[model samples]
Target: MNDWRSHFGFHTTPFTRELAVAQRFPLPMFDEVLTALSRAVDQRGSAALVAPAGTGKTALLRALVDQLPEARYRVHYVKVTDLSKRDLCREIAVACGAQPAGSFPMLVRRLQEHFLSTLADDGVRPVLVLDDSHGLRPEVLGIFQILTNFEMDSRLVLSVLFVGQPPLRDLLRQPAHEAVTRRLVHLATLRLLSRPESHRYLAHRCTIAGATTIPFDPGAQEAVYEIACGNLRATDQLAAKALEVAHDAGAAIVDSAHLATSRRLLWP
Candidate 1:
């Protein structure tokens, strides 16, 4: 029988298969975010999720959207890195399936009206997900405050969720932003994965990629854990490179040498 390594190309590494592998990796903190966001969505309150880069914030949001039953909610995902109020409004209008019939201000008001009406008709609140919200300008963010006007006494007609880096928490702390910050009833700050968690993460990804057994040697796992520093992105990168190194060396199983090469390629 041909060796497993011989069947797959030398360049076929876990990194190249990240999308497929990542889907199978059980993000442990995902449940926390899901619970928090689900509560916020159900309660019709605002939510803020803050985390460092590569802590899987975006992935969590996508997963949350996927898990939510479509019959109950309409989720609109937006990335607000560098947008003017008008542009932001336009994006929201588009996502909500409303066409603005007049000037930007008039369009915004119309969009707001349309959103509230749609929620009322559908019997389900609308969820607007703002990714990288820290970069939003004060004026653009003010537009978000305007959206809060759609709320009723019982629940919000529209709910907004802000996901961003650590600075977002600091930004919200400013006195001028207090009104908006006060509306955020749900919040979560994601942290790097623990060592054991990281191990499970890597194993999960490898298994998803068709590896029946742990691909890396015991010592190699330690090296990967150290080099990845508990970051999922770095872990994926290292694992991919290690797989490539093993493939190129014609090794049936990944070992320390492959990990060493992976480290040099990733960090250097």
Candidate 2:
């Protein structure tokens, strides 16, 4: 099998999810959100990022983490899973480099002390990033208020950033979760790319992969935008399959016909 990278004159596969920080495309949609999150972090406040699936929510989180200065922020990223409150605290304890073996109540106190000591001893703000928080159980999410409370929530010792899909926003809006919602300094949302932006997005991916010229033709790009509706993950899947179809056909450039085949193979 001909390697797609070499076949397409790319140093690496384009449209991959695991893009290096330096190689990540600048997403303008996230600029305001980045600023808001950074401000929240500086103020030791909390923020929520809501977006539809495949719209680069995780990517935006990574970008935000990358932009934050290490000297000022100790960022700990956690991908929330369906777990009991005790298990969740264990996960957080591990992330913060604290002992994870303990009773539920003891674990909470230990994590709290770790956060306080991280600030008092290291003099760097600790920012906890929870990705896919929409999956968190209501009871588990509620624990955040208790975890963040220091001196009755008057002194903010830890900044928390929650990144999730729209369901997360709905979860936060419920009266039951008011304790967590009230602490939110900002709520940012991400949208799919526009038509023109989709074109540039593809080109940017290609350029970063070491392509001097875009291998996807204009019509093919339009087909991708139409099929994926500008969602980054969908676009990436369609574009990657389209490239494979084009390469298999010994085509120099991906065209509408390749995209059509990709849509059929990928969706059907």
Candidate 3:
């Protein structure tokens, strides 16, 4: 077979990792998450997104970025690390387009100046989105307070969005982290879809890929749900692989057999 997408009459690769914002499925949970996080950033408030792996944390982060207007908000995505406080400042400085060189205190001043300048000069609120933040050390996570100290915390010049897995929630709940935790205005979460939502999600993905009709039969859909348990990334991987398996076997539509083959090929 040439390619599964072609065999299935798809104009583009379905269940792909890269998708335009407009092409994203209208999952109610995703919409709710975006709305809550967007509201937090718009109000110059901080937030945390805690979800398990493959629940679409990165996708939702990208969507939230698109949701915020560039003219109003300058979003900086910082890759989290277990670095020292000064090194972490360097990382954040680099993300904020500030010169990433200085002692810890100097770097903090410089970053504060940069943020104040952006707000004063361009009328833009700078947002720091830290992904994989569950990996950040307690000392490093404490840096949020230093980052947000604007005019004795009276001025709201920056917003920090913490994106991580469930452990992040527990990490933030520590008594030592109470100051930073208090700053978070919202905590958004993404969940595995229900069975019916999984079916609709697959259909919506097919539509987004320019398919005239969904190719997964009922049996195949159920199999994917049972195996993937409605995690968005898992569903995408299983369904895409199942389509390939079906195409290789010259099947007209994906069925439970194809899904079973996909399970073996993917898991075993």
Residue pairs that clash (backbone atoms under 3 angstroms), model 3: none
Q: How accurate is candidate 1 locally (lDDT)?
A: 0.76
Give Cα-based local distance difference scores for all models.
Answer: 0.76, 0.89, 0.91
User: What TM-score against the true fold does each predicted structure earn?
Assistant: 0.87, 0.96, 0.96
Residue-wise C-alpha lDDT for candidate 1, range 1-268, written one tens digit per residue: 2444334423234444336323646664778777889889888888999988877888888877877678877898988768777777887778778883466788778877776776778776688999998888766666666787655434467788999998888788888778788888988878888888888887777665566677777877878888887887888888877877887787877887788888888776
**How many residue-pair clashes does candidate 1 contain?**
0
lDDT tens readout by residue for model 2, 1-268: 2587678888887889878877766776678788998999998999999999998878878888899999888998899999999999998889889999989999989988999998999899899999999989988888899889997777899988999988998899999999899999999998999998999999999999888989998899899899999899999999999988998999999999999999999986
Where does candidate 1 stray beyond 4 Å?
Answer: 1-24, 100-102, 151-155
Clashing residue pairs in candidate 1 (N, C-alpha, C atoms within 3 angstroms): none
Ranking by lDDT: 3, 2, 1
Model 3, 70-173: lDDT tens per residue? Answer: 99999999879788999989999999899999899999999999999999999989999999899888888787998888999899989999999899999999
* Best model number under lDDT: 3
- Candidate 2 regions exceeding 4 Å error are none
